[model samples]
Target: MAEEEKTDRIEKRRRQSPKGEERRAEILAAALRRFAEDGYQNAAIGDIARDVGLSLPGLLHHFPTKVDLLLAILAKQDIDSADFIGHFRSDLRSLLKGMVDIFRRNAGMIEVVRAFAILNAESLMKDHPAKTWFLNRTARMQNDIAVTFERAIAEGSIDGGVDAMAMAAELIAMMDGLQMLWLRQPDRFDMVGGLEAYVNRLLTSLGLEH
Candidate 1:
């Protein structure tokens, strides 16, 4: 009887495991909706569970807390960078192209951008998880852009005197600003054209007669 009980428990655990992941994703989806529809402070976990057809316990099983869910959603942006390389295939052009593709693909995740910025603006606190994660993530991306800038300079694709680190920071800042602006006016911003235009300006500044 003990062996049978153990076997039953194993089967039940297996059944619950997949359900746990699915339930967690559902919880996150609903949580994002609630956070978007009603400010994050106003959105409750129970309502998220109800929207996703999961019990509060099930949601908890997937995300230990609300912050965990929020972080997961934010991390989703990095996870969605699959087509990023295609944008910069023949130098920085590929990277720029990837930005256009990514912005288009991640338009929904743009909501996460607004939520984070809003929360961050509410407090200038430094040790918060959202702020830390976003800072680290953007820093990493900037470093990558700096590396790209360095390589382009070596290939004579861009100006050698331009500080890669500074350029990277400026580039990322421009992109982030564009993203927020685009969120507000998708029809007006033209992300693809804007990025291409920025690259052209950089090339022209580098004496490349673009």
Candidate 2:
């Protein structure tokens, strides 16, 4: 009887596992699609739940609030960003290559770029749950790039006299601007091409062999 009970428990757990993971992925996909198409302010939590064939209460059980889901989505993107940055260090060329690879590797992320850009632009609203989080997160990314810049300059791979902070700002601004432009002309913007061009231009201006 004990063995039979153990087997029953195992079967029950096994039956739940795939369904749970499937539901989680379904929720994420629905959120991504809605966020991409309708902007954050316009997306309804119920709609996301409906997209996944979940009741509103069921979705709430997984993510207590809409902001929670948004934060989770951003967190996932942050992990991807960190991985790419980790794989490519202080080299300007590697940085450029990494960005290209990331854009291609997660093409679906471009959808994310749409609504995120809209929200980021209005991030000055103090009540915005994302404002503080986004600000601190971006600051950290800039700090990482600044550190990389410092190392590259010290190693003579990149030129001296460049302010790491300023360079980091410029790089971020360049990428953000390109993303904005890409949304308007997704078919023609060539996201990778623009990033590579900007990096090459910056390197060339600094007298680097990039």
Candidate 3:
């Protein structure tokens, strides 16, 4: 009888543990929807909790604070983005093409995109919590693009005289600029097409295959 009771208790715990994880996932999903729709600062934690049928402390039990939830969302995005970028890591042209494809896909999620845009602009403030994150993201992107350029140059795929680091910075600037434009006039502006054209021109200028 003692062994049976222990086995039943263990089974109950196993079942309850998954319920806890499921509740956490539910909170994250609701938080993401709220964040994507309203941006980070404007998204109310109380609202998110209410949307998920939980009270303030209940939501807090899972995510501590709004910043914690935002960080988790960003971390998840980074993981997904890493996977997306991994598919075409072979060459600069391939990576650019892959990026354009990603832009096209992301266009459907305008609210989420807008949320990122707002956070990016707001995080430029000196003391913003996300400032360091944005800065690090920019640096990492620049480095990756520079590495791709260097690889192309080494393989005789591009003009050797061109500065990889400078070109990488320029490319990042163009990408950011185009995204802003797309957000303003999404229907009128063709973000993916614009990127494709710009990349083709860049390759042409570098004497590289597009």
Estimate TM-scores for all models.
0.78, 0.87, 0.87
lDDT of 2 by residue, 141-160 (tens): 78877888888889887668
Candidate 2 residue pairs that clash: none
Write candidate 1's Cα lDDT for 116-136 as tens digits. 545544324555557676667
- After best superposition, candidate 2 residue 65: deviation in angstroms? 1.6
**Tens digits of per-residue lDDT for model 3 on 1-210?**
799999999999999999998887788788878876777778899999999899999899889989998887778778877666567768878887777887888788876677778788879877877788889888887788788888988998877887988987897788778888998998899988998898888767777677
- Candidate 2 or 1, higher lDDT: 2
With a 3 Å backbone cut-off (N, CA, C), the pairs that clash in candidate 1 are: 87-94, 87-95, 87-98, 88-94, 88-95, 89-94
Ranking by lDDT: 3, 2, 1
What lDDT would candidate 3 get against the real structure? 0.83
In angstroms, the error of model 2 at 196 is 1.8
Q: Which stretches of candidate 2 lie over 4 Å from their true place?
A: 1-7, 106-108
